[model samples]
Target: MDYFFAVVAPLAVVIIGGCTVRSVKIISEENEALVERLGKFHRKLESGLNFINPILDTVVLEDTLSERVLELKPSQAITKDNVSLIIDAVLYWRVIELELAYYKVQDIEEALRKLVLTTLRSEIGEMDLQKTFYSRKDINKAMLRELDDVTDRWGVKVTRVEVQEITPTPKVIEAMELKRAAEFKKQADILEAEGTVRAMELLSTAIKSQSNSKDILQFLVAQRYVEANQKLSESPNAKIVFMGSEPLGSSMGELLNNSTISPPESNGSNSKSK
Candidate 1:
């Protein structure tokens, strides 16, 4: 009985070793494999232990179903304003239907890349440089929606689309900065003029209410004159001029009174005159 048991044990070990080496497969978690029987689709080998007919079944492809990131290179695009920009993006995607992904597209990665680039350029061409900067989220959502529609048939689920960078050309950047500075300067000048007008109105009201208004006005004018001299003294080639505070105050009051705008004549009066 011992001799028979020893012979059978050796034969069993050989058979088990051969099966383990050739037929058995361990598919990792989150991974899948496709098998073909005589060059025809047989079955999908899912995660965990799987056995295949060593002679007939062959693994055609193995891939993971996990989410993946595809980073796009900076592509040059012209905005609606004809401003050239360099933009890059990232795509979060995953294969929902492995069979469709493998058979439908010859090269899935290349197809997705081209599709994304085309969509990005199309969206960018619809917006100006300023809109492109402000509407970043809108562009991302639009791309995601557009890509999802097209890639649905390709078994790709684009989870998220992100615009990583949108940068204008160096010359465009400099021009934009200059334009912004001009806008700021114009705003400042308008505010300063409005403030001066408001101050003159307040001074006119004070003069009407008080008897010593002339003395107060002359003192204010002298203070402004000193401030102007101090600012001019900081300049490399400043020419200082001295003038009496009383004359300066009188002239300032006359200038303020003359700053009012005359209203246009009534249309009825003009017609009657004609």
Candidate 2:
């Protein structure tokens, strides 16, 4: 009975130890495993049950290979218009190539942040302040493209770039505001001048079309006379005059004779006498 008990106990312990050693593995929902054999990369393990030889091979490093957000601090940059501004940005990226991401770059986050800043300065340095403020989306897109190109070799993928904040100096802000105001005023003046020119052109066209019509001229003159009469009646110090050709002189001779008036000045008679 003693011999049988010793043999059975040793067999059960060995089985339990083997199961425990085989159960050692990494479990995750959103991660990948890099397996190594003799300190050299052997294969990549996908999500699920991953087995490893605990004695001969081991998990040298555990890395969560997923998308990450890199926030950058404000950096001084010079614009095309010689204005200096501090710009802050955020970068969205992911590690696509786990092999390159883990082995090539020492620190992925730091490298990504530094690359973003360098690319942003180069892009923004070529544009003016107004463009930088308004064209942030466009600039971000361009920076993303540039970063993608440069980082592709390093196995890093840049998903998107965003300009978080742009802070220009107070003096630069004032100058930009003044410049914008002046530009708006110039545009308004141009529009007003165009409207006045259009109105003048229409008036000239109407005058030309009615040059041979006496009725139209008479109506215009009557309208002016009515307006003048109404304005004059509002104030006792105003005087209104509505005149015509020699027809009034011929028909109303008695009225002209009663008033202190002279005949129409004749240039021909005056020149002949001189």
- Cα TM-score per model: 0.61, 0.58
Quantify all predictions' global Cα lDDT against the true fold. 0.87, 0.77
* Model 2 CA lDDT for position 154: 78
Model 2 spans > 4 angstroms off: 1-23, 174-274
Candidate 1: tens digits of C-alpha lDDT, residues 42-66: 8989999999988888988889999
- Which residue runs of candidate 1 sit more than 4 Å off their true CA positions? 1-20, 178-274
Which candidate achieves the best lDDT against the true structure? 1
Best by TM-score: 1
- Residues 163-185, model 2: lDDT tens digits: 98878977888987999999999
lDDT of 2 at 185: 100
Query: Among all windows of ten consecutive residues in candidate 2, which has the lowest summed lDDT?
Result: 256-265
